[model samples]
Target: MQYEFRPSGVCSSKIVLDVEGDIVRKVQFVGGCSGNSQGIGALVQGMKVDDVIGRLRGIRCGRRNTSCPDQLAQALLLYQSKNETKE
Candidate 1:
């Protein structure tokens, strides 16, 4: 499934993510540090969503309370809230 997440308290305006089960397939960030965003996108591919969240959540950008990575984690949580596992 795919999710579009809007970030707050960060430079990135939006994040687009594709995941199958808990593994991430693709990640795209809009309006952020281009190189870092691309790097993050590449690194998270094929990783478990929960694992990504654990690593990325609660990160701060300089003095602020949230970073792009943190926002991505929030996005994953939002995704979890909306998608129920199929038996």
Candidate 2:
């Protein structure tokens, strides 16, 4: 499934993801730190959605409650929940 998420309290305004079952096939961010966004995308490719959430969740950027990575984690969690509800 392909999902697009709008993140809150972060530099990135948008996160686009492709997921198959529980695995993440691709992640793309819009309107964020370009290098960091690209790096995060590369790092999470082909990773399990749950694993990404575990690793990236709760990470803070400076004093803010969430970073782009954390936003990705949240996005994945939302995706998981939505999928679960459909089953």
Best by lDDT: 2
| lDDT of residue 81 for candidate 2 | 92
**Model 2: what TM-score?**
0.97
What TM-score would you give candidate 1 relative to the actual structure?
0.94
TM-score of each: 0.94, 0.97
lDDT of 2 by residue, 1-87 (tens): 899999999998899999999999999999989999999999999999889999999999999988999999999999999999999
Instruction: Give residue 51's lDDT in candidate 2 (0 to 100).
Output: 94
lDDT of 1 at 77: 89
lDDT at residue 50 of model 1 (Cα atoms): 90
- List the candidate 1 regions with Cα displacement exceeding 4 Å: 85-87
Query: CA lDDT, every prediction?
Result: 0.94, 0.95
Encode model 1's per-residue lDDT on 2-69: one tens digit a residue.
88999999999999999998899999999999999999999999999999999999999999999999
Backbone clash total for model 1 is 0
What is the clash tally of candidate 2? 0
